[model samples]
Target: MPETARIRNVAVVGHRGTGKTSLVEALLFQSGAINRLGAVEAGTTISDADEDEHKRQLSIALSLTHATWQERKLNLVDIPGDPSFQGELRTAARVVEGLLVTVSGVMGVEVGTSRAWRLGDELGLARVVFVNMLDRERADFFRTLEQLRSQLSPQCVAVHIPIGTEHELTGIVDVLHMCAYASPEGAKEGEPGPIPDDIADIAAEYREKLLDAVVETDEALMERYLEGQELDAHEVAAALKAAVTKGEVFPVACGVATKNLGTHAVLDLLVEGVPSPAKKGSPIDVDGASTAVFVFKTVADPFAGRINLFRVLKGRVTAETTLVNLRGKGKERLGSLLELQGKEHKPALDYAEGDIGGVAKLKEAQTGDLLVDKEVAIEVPDFGFPEPVMSFAITPKTKGDEEKVATSIRRLAEEDQTLHLRRDQQTGEEILSGMSQMHVEVALERAKRRFGVDIELHPPRVPYRETIRREARAHGRYKKQTGGRGQFGDCHIVVSPFEEGEYEFVDKIVGGVIPQSYRPAVNKGIQEAMHHGELAGAPVQGVRVQLVDGSYHTVDSSEMAFKIAGSMAWKDAYMNADPVLLEPIMELEASVPDDVV
Candidate 1:
């Protein structure tokens, strides 16, 4: 594994179609990491290599890749921008030190922009918003900057201004150095050139604005600038980086990712401008003790079993180490370490602070489990998952498929945190739920692809409760005659509502009318019978049954005979008890669009 100091872990976040994945490809291409860039529509991009992602034309999971720039190793994570895949975004946040938020110059200040801003704020990550898509029509850098100021935050300031408008984007003005960088392909370290003739005045104006934003971070710089003293480029860069990493100032840069414009320059800015993990705050924790690693995703394979992806927070982890699972409570051994590159895994032995990696199947370890060193037990807080809002009932097609359905559902749930599968206790139906209808459909697709389990989905049944409205009495008798022996039992039961909310069973027999041993058998039968109501086959609730009187034959009576008698009595009494079905009304507190509400 690589040391933390040599590693640059940064997350590329932005709205959909802002060219985040394309920027990643460009970075890889220029860094000599990959020979050629793959297109998103072709479903051959390195980051979006997953089959499900390719079919959907979007990233469903965080894609982890690495590249090297100027002797420094960069760990790049490209995250999905869609809300349904926010799980991937959260995973990326746990592993990176700085955020590179991409914004489309054509569509400024979008919903994705607002979301990424708030996410970075919540994680306390240093931010640098790259305004991309400069060559497209209606792509106004200045207008986009104004929109960012109005909708996002006023702390944003331009550090680099484009040289010209659309179709004429040949270079950019460096505000700090008072220099112009021209690129035929818009890459960094291109042949140095004099400031372009047309945009020199505009560059001069923004350079002062850039200097003003930097000077506020240091009193000496502020005084020097206010007194008309000129500061050098090196001094300016240092102050600007400090302010940006400290969340005082957010410097915006512009480029066209698809045309390979300004990508290398953006890479340089990330390496030089972003903060290192050591300078960042300590890792996240739950209690007073330092945090242990918690995995948010696991991929099950027929050959590999399970590949668990996780982030190391407070401590170092190596192969063959044992950890106590605060959730699973069993000791888990760290298997072979893995660094994910596209869909492949590169072998490693250990990982350090703020590093993201994976390990082969850890028996008994699961997502949301805090893997402690066992000697020093500490628990990390679990990651939050949105509640599943949509549901469907799934049934298998083939004979003897009922048991396979449960196993397949569990495996699918293990893979997707957003998916939930459980038996509806009230309705007695197996329900699979997720964020939306499409989410559940994707889960079904994965089930067929990964687990080879085919299922038919139907609307989930509505769960209802059943209760009795009046009291009733029932007497039941059970007798079995055989050649050698006989069985006889009798019981009288009184059924009524128990305060209209509680379900209880009481034995009030006196004078040894029925043996104490037989009383439990009667209660068991009533409890078992309560599982299915007489109406609509729903579970019965809010009622109590009492065993009042009964007689038993000394030699012939048995527990089975008493149970049968009690079950019969309950069924007979239930019809006359005035049972009614009660529909469940969910008291929902939701924050939706005002028009919908």
Candidate 2:
């Protein structure tokens, strides 16, 4: 295992289609982690390897991979940028100490970009913004940099600027070192050289701004800068690192992720600028000799069973370690620790503090659960999943497949916290809800492909009920004559609007008009009638019934006879009680464009 001081855990996050995945691939290739560069269009990128992700050409889940740069192990988490998959991004935020937010040079600022910035702020993560796609048409690095400064934070300043504009983007000028790195077509690392005379003026301007920002971290440096004292490059770099660790500055870099240009510089900056896990300090206090690990993501593989991916917050975890789940209050025996590379698992000797690893087939462990030593009790904060906005009723395509579909959905829900499943009691339909319609569709596709369960989706039905607005009284009687015995029963009931509950049945009989044992039978029959309402076959509610008087034959008027008489009396009173159908009311809030409104 790499030492905690040399391990840098960083998350690559940004808006959809901002080339986050491509940037990760470029970093991996530049670091010698992989010999060949992978492209998203070719579906060969290691991170976006899932079938659904390949079909959509977008990441739908969090991908974990690592690389060695300058002898420092960088654990990179490539998260999905689509809003529908924000849960994956939230999970990534919890484990990583720093964030590299990518902004498209052409698109500038977007909803996803803004959201990522806000989330990074909430998590208190040190951030480095990369202006990507500089080689694409209409891409402008300076314009995007200004947008970032105006919209996200004024502390955002460019440490590196593209040497040329779109179509002529061949190199980057490093403001800190006052040098340039130029690359030819299809090259991985650029050759360092003196800054071009044409770009030197602008590079100097940004370098001065960078120096000014870096000095703010120290009062002595700021005083030296005001007095026009020359500062060493190493001192400036040290101040920049200090400011970034405190979230006082967000260092900006530029690159074309698709072309692998400037990626080597990005890796260099990550190693030199971003803080290691040890430097960032532990998120929680680790005073005692206890172990604690937080499970951020759970994978439900059919063949492999449940795989738990967790980050060690304190102490050490090894094979055969027994940990207690604080949420479940149960003991868990950890068998083997595995290092994750996308979906592949490699055996790991142990996971030390500030390290992340995975284990297979954890029975009571799940996402957001904390596994700790029995002596320590601690609670980890959970990711706030957005409420589902779209819902659809799902049905099995074939009969007798309901259980299969349900089991599959439950398993998928275990993997994705954003997917919700519930049964509409009134409509008797299984409803699937998600962030969007496409989110639900992707979940269904996974269910079909992974679990071999086919289902049909439809709009969910609204549930309604029936209630009375007025009161009425009625008399009901039942008599029958057969061969040697005769059946006879009579009842009188008063029905009124009930304010306390759905329905209430009161027994009020005098002089043994109705037998004590038979009163309960009357209540049962009324309940049955209420369930199968008289109008629209909906359930009846908000009504009360009082059994005031009744008569019965001793030999023939049994519980069955009283039950039938009670049913008749309820129907007779309900018809005269002025009943009305009540539709379901939904309290909803929606956001719409002004023109549409």
Candidate 3:
């Protein structure tokens, strides 16, 4: 097992198209985890290996991988940038101690960038900003840094400045070291050199500002700086790490992830500046005796069955351990412990406290579940999943495939918490809802491809109702005189609008006018009529019926006869009692960009 102090769990998150995946790929390559760097456009990046994600050229799920840098184990989680996959991002945020938020230097601050920053603030995790895409045309690091200062926290200070702008970007000036590093095309490590003459003044200015920010975090350092003493670089570096851990400052770095430019510096900063899992705090309090694991995600592989990815919050978990699932209150036998690398898994002997690992085929365990020793019981808080905004009514393409479709939907929902499935009680349609149209569409595609279920999508129907407007009375009679035992029945009913509930039936007949046994038949017939309303064929609501008078022959008056009379009486009275169709009204809350509104 790896020592807790040597583990650095950080999540890479940002807006879509901001080079988050690329940055992760570059980090892996620089650390020698992968032989070659993979590009996002080619769908070969280790973080985005899902077939659907490859087809779409965007990340649809969270990817977990690890690298070793400077003898420190860095566990990196690459999260989807799209809002539709915010559930994955939030889960990643909860497990990691630090957030590496990448911002597009060309686009500056976008909506996703703001959201990523807010998530970090909410979790109180140490944050580091990477101004990516510096090699792209029109990319400006200083402009992006200014935007971060205004939009995010003003505590954000630059630790590294670009040597040039846009296409001319070839190197970066390390402000803390007061030196420049030349990064030619396709180079993994930049050559250290003196600061360039052109941007020397600018670098010095930012360096002074950085020093000012760093000194404020420590009183002794502040005194040294105020006394006209030059602060040592090592002292400043140590102070910067402390300040970052305390959330007093967010150090900014720059890189072009696609070209692997300046990534080695970023790795050095991560090892030096970010806190270990032990320092960031554990998800659960350590009780010293009991074992605890929090399952953050579940993957349903068609071949391997259920795979649960979890973090050991306390104690050690080995292959022979048996855990109790707090959510289900059932015993779960431990399978082989595994560590994940994209879609591949490697068997592990055990997972120590503060380490993240996976277990395959836990019968009763699920995402957000707490697995602990049999003697201990605890509930792990759930990641807050956003409400689904888009909805679609689904129909099985094959006539008898409804059950198959439903099973597929459930499995898919298990994989993605953002996807929701429910039967519309009013419309009687199986509805699938998600964060966006694309989210639902992708789920349906997965259902078809992964589970062999095909379905057609349509807009959900509005559930409407029919109600009575006024009160009216009518008499109905049924008689047959063709045979020896003829059927005969009669009834008089009064109908009116009701406010208490959907529909009510009352018996007002007296003196055996309607027999007590036959009254139920009359009520049943009227309820059937209400189900198929007089207006628009919608279900009837807000109405009442009263059986005032009725007559029946002793031998000829059967339950069927009375039921027929009740149905006829309801139809006559409903026509005279004015009725109207009521469409359902739903209150909705919408979120939009300020410019759109």
Candidate 4:
């Protein structure tokens, strides 16, 4: 097991089209994890290995990949920037202690930037900003830096400045080292050199600002700086890590990710500035010192039953380590403990405390489930999912494939907590819901591709109900004299709004006006009328029907005649009583940053 100081679990988050994945690729390539860099346009990147992602050209799910920088393992979880896939974003936030927030150099501080920053604040996560895509048209690093300061936080200080503008961009100025690091087009890493004269003065200014921010986090450093004593890079870096972990400072780095410019500088900052899990992770009870794994994400693999990616919260876990699932209280052996490189699984020795790892084929382990050793006990953290915003009714395209469709939906929902399958009580249709319409569509598409079950999406039918407003009375006389033993029935009824309940029928008959045996027929008829209301043909609600005075032929007043009379009378009274239609409403609360709005 690696010491807690060597492990750094970070989530790469930003808006769509901000080169989050591209930056991750550059980092991996610079660290020698991959020999070649893969472009997102070609869909050859390891992080985005799914076919659906290739088709959409956007991340619909989070991907886990790691790189080694100076013998320190950096577990990089690349999360989708799109708001529609916020579920994945939240999932990544739950397990990681730091965030590598990517900002588009051209677009500056966008909606996604604000959202990610606020999320970091919400979780008290240490944040590092990368101003990516500086090689694109109209990309400005200084302007984006100002936006980061004004929009995100005043503590957003730059540790590096870009060497050139769009198209002419070649390198970055490492403000902390007071030097320049340039990378030629297609280079794997940037080499440090003397800072350009044109940007030297500006780099010094940013360096001074960085020192100012870093020293404030440490009283001793501040006092030393106040006494005119110079602080070296190492002193500032150590203080910067504490500041970043406490969210008192945010260090900004610049890069053209596709060209791999400033890749090594970013990695160096990540290792030097980001906090180890021990500083940022939740405090653990030393008395309950035993292995515990918190499963944060689960991927449903066809060949492998379930791939649960977990964070070792308390102690180390390795292959064949049997742990008790907190949910099911069942023993689950770590059969295939592996570290993930996107879809590829590499065998892992063990995941130390606060380190993330994957284990395939746990019996009932799932997202948000904590598995602890039998000797250890802990409460599972609640990583609540976003309520599905859009819903649609889905049915199997082919008949008698209901079981297959339902099974596919169930399995899909298991993998994605945001995807939901529910049956509408009023419409009697299977409803599929997700964060957005596209979210639902992509899940359904995956169900088709993975489970071999095809389903058709229909607009979710509105569960409208019906009710009466006013009190009204009516009479119905059904008299048929054909030949012998004809049908003769007479009844009166009043339909009114029932304040307390959904539906009620009262028989107010006296002196055998309507026979006792046939009175139940009156109630049955009114109930049948309640099923189909008068307004939109929906089920009537909060209706009270009263069977008042009525005459019936002793011989021909059978249950059938009275039933028809009651039905006719109730229909007339319902129409006379002001009827209204009601639809179900959902109350949703959204936590959106003002800048994003």
Candidate 5:
């Protein structure tokens, strides 16, 4: 296990088309973790392995991959950009202390960029921006830098500037050090060189901008610099790191992830500017001597059981370690831990404190589970997943495949907290809820492909209800005489709209007109009637039924008879009370471009 301070957990996140996964491949290639680089369009990126991800050419889930940079381990969590997958971002934030937010050099700050920035702000994570796709058409580093300053934060400062623009892009200039690096396509390392004569003035201009922001972290350095003294490069670099860790400044770097341009600088930035997990501190309060691990993500593998990915919060974890789950209170024996590089699992020797690793076949563990030493007792806060924004009714293709369909979807929901599966009692239809339409569709597709269960999806039932609009009265009398004993029940009820709440029953009957025992039976009968409304067979809502007066025979007025009388009285009054149908109405706010209007 490496030193805890040498481990840096960073999540790579950005909008779609910003080349986040491509940049991860470049970092992996530059660090020699992988000999070849993979493109997402070709379905070869390490971050995206699911079949649907390949079909859509998008990242659907978070992927964990580590790169060895400058004798340090960089745990790079590649996250999806789509809004539906924001749950993955929250999961990554809990374990990582730094966020490497990718931005398109062409489009600049977009919806995902803003969202990622706001998340980092909320979590107090140090953020670094990478302007990717610098070699694409209409790509402008300076323009994007301005956008970052205006849209994200005025504290945004450029540390690395592109040497060229668009198709002629070649390398980047390290503005802080007044140095240049020339890294062309397929270059593993940026060749150190002098600043080009053509862009020397511009590089100097950015260096001053970098210094102006960096010097504020140290008053003495700022005073000396203000006195016209040249600050030491090392001193400035140290201050920059502190400022970034404190979120006083957000340093921006430029790159074309596809061509591996400017990737080394980003890796160097991660090693230098980002704080280690040990320095950032853990979210869980654990005893110093005991080991603790928080399971942030789970993969439901039908063949391999559950693969749990966790961050070591306290002590080290090895092959012989036994952990007790805080939530389930079950002792889980040690299993061979593995490192998840995309879908490939490599044997991991051990996990040091604050390091993340995956283990398979735990007896009983799920996402958000805190597993620790038996002696250590602590409470783990949940991930607090966002509610699903969309829902669909699901029906299995085969008549008897209901259990299989529900079981598969529930298993997937365990892995994806944003995907929720439930059964509607009113309609008796299985409903699947998710962050978006694509989120639900992808889950259903995965269920069919992996679990061998197919289901049809459509709009969920409206869950409408029925409520009365006016007041009406009716009398119900039941008298059946056939032999020595006869059945007799009489009751008068007034049905009126109760706008405040659902189904209020009042007994205004005085004296022995309706017996006390039979009164409860009448209320029970009215409650049953509330389940099926008179209009559209929907559930009844917001109506009050009152038993004002009635007469009952001494022998024949049993609870059953009174119950039947109450049922009859409710139906008669409901029909004359002018029942109305009610439906759920959704309130939404949308943002549209000006031209669309």
Candidate 6:
């Protein structure tokens, strides 16, 4: 078993195609966690296994993979950076203790880069930036570095300097150690090499900047640095770790993910430079007194049932352990704990605090559920994802596929929080809402592929309401002549506007003109009429109906007769009371292109 303190839960995030996934593959391969490195473009990478992801060549969900590098278990999560799939990034962010935010040297500071950085800041997660794909033509490390410093944070200082230029990218100098790792990715075939001469001056300059931040953490080091005394590599390493733990500095690391340049150096930093859970802070609260475990995602598999991906925030969770799901308000039994490799689940018997795991067949579990011991209950803070801005009206193409559509949509909603489905009340349309047009399109595609359900989508309809502009009185009389008996009833109602959302009915008939016993029947009839609107056929709200006068025969005027009379009178009053159509206007907040605006 790996030491719980030695475990590092880090998520890699940035804009798409920044080599974030490739970095994880390289880390796992070089660490011997996998026999061979898988390429993302070839769709052979372990973490990019979803058909939708492979087809689009873009990750649609969070992928968790693990590897042991130098006896330290690194739980790496590669999160999709697209705004449409941002819920996945938020899910991964809620669990990981640190963030390895990747930046493409060519793009420098991008919209996604800022977004990932903001997410990390919101979670208070320790962060390290890797300027990746430096081997690509036009990849500018120094330009990206300057942009990061200007935009991300001034504290984002480089600790390692790239020794060669783009396309000629070779290795990096560990400014803290004054030693060079020959591999551009880190740790070549044999022992580490000396600093490359070409970038020695650049390395020295960054070394001073790193020391300036690190020395502040220790009084002795501060004095030595003030006196212009050079600290040894080990001292600098210890101070850098302490500074990073305290968030005084975020040491920037650079690498070429495909060429394996600084990948091993990053692993070394995780083991030797990152802080343990104990040093970081307290265990996350479960409900009241118990430890908290948040299930950030749920993956549905037809053959395997479901895999609930969770982050153990406080205590250890073992197989067969029963826990409370605050979201479901029910107790769930953990069948088995597993580690995820993209969509695949590897069974495990135990999971410790701050580590991510998948519990198979958690019948009552869903994404955003806080699982804890039943005796102690606590709410986990949830991530804020963008609300869906567009909607689609969808229906099953065939009667046989109706149930399949519902089931598939429910599963899709579980996988992507921003995807929502509901029956629109006004138009009676089955509406699907998502972040964008593409989001809904992909949802339909997934439904067909996963559940074998075909659906047709249409534009959603707007809801409209009806209201009265002027007060009016109405009287309805219903009389029935049957061969054996007869029915008779009469009612007088005054229709008027109340405060919006306030619906009231008062029995104002005096001297029992309409018997008190039958007045309830009259009000019930009017309320029922209000549900299916009088004008534009929408639910009527915020109106008042008063029973001012009515007449009834105890034997002839039954409840049914009174009900009919009330409906007739209300509809009569609604049509003649200056009724007008009121369209339902939904408050919208969206970020669109300035040009579109």
On lDDT, the leading prediction is 5
> Who is ahead in lDDT, 1 or 3?
3
User: Which 10-residue window of candidate 3 scores lowest in summed lDDT?
Assistant: 588-597
Put down candidate 4 lDDT per residue, 213-308, tens digits, no spaces: 889889999999999998988888888877877788999999888888878877877776677887766433324747777788889765666799
**Arranged by lDDT, best first:** 5, 3, 2, 4, 6, 1
Inter-residue clash pairs, candidate 2: none
Comparing 4 with 6 on TM-score, the higher-scoring candidate is: 4
* TM accuracy, model 2: 0.83
Name the regions of candidate 5 deviating beyond 4 angstroms: 300-305, 375-377, 587-597
RMSD of each: 5.5, 4.5, 4.2, 4.2, 2.5, 4.3
Off by over 4 Å in 2: 184-186, 284-289, 300-305, 465-597
TM-score to native of every candidate shown: 0.77, 0.83, 0.84, 0.86, 0.94, 0.82
Error of 4 at 19 (Å): 1.0
* TM-score between model 6 and native: 0.82
Where model 4 places Cα greater than 4 Å from the true spot, the runs are 282-289, 302-305, 375-378, 469-531, 541-571, 583-597
Better of 3 and 4 by TM-score: 4
Q: Name every residue pair that clashes in candidate 3.
A: none
Q: What ranking emerges by TM-score with the best candidate at the front?
A: 5, 4, 3, 2, 6, 1
lDDT per residue (tens digit) for residues 1-597 in model 1: 666666677888988778888888778877778777677788877888667888888877777777888777787889887766666676667667788888988988777777778778887888888898888889999999987777777788997888777887877777777777765462434655688777888889999888888899989899999899889888989898788778888889887766566666677777766676656744465344353676756776455578887777656788866777777678888867787776667778888766677888788766666676644545454456657777899888776787887887788677677778888876668899886777777777777887678888999888877889999999989999886678877999999987655788888998898998888888877778878888977778898898899999998888888988888899899989999998876566643322225
Backbone clashes in model 1, listed as residue pairs:
186-262
**How many times do residue backbones clash in model 4?**
1
Residues 43-147, candidate 2: write the lDDT tens digits: 989888788899999999888888999998888999999989998888888888889999999999887888889888998988988999998899998889888
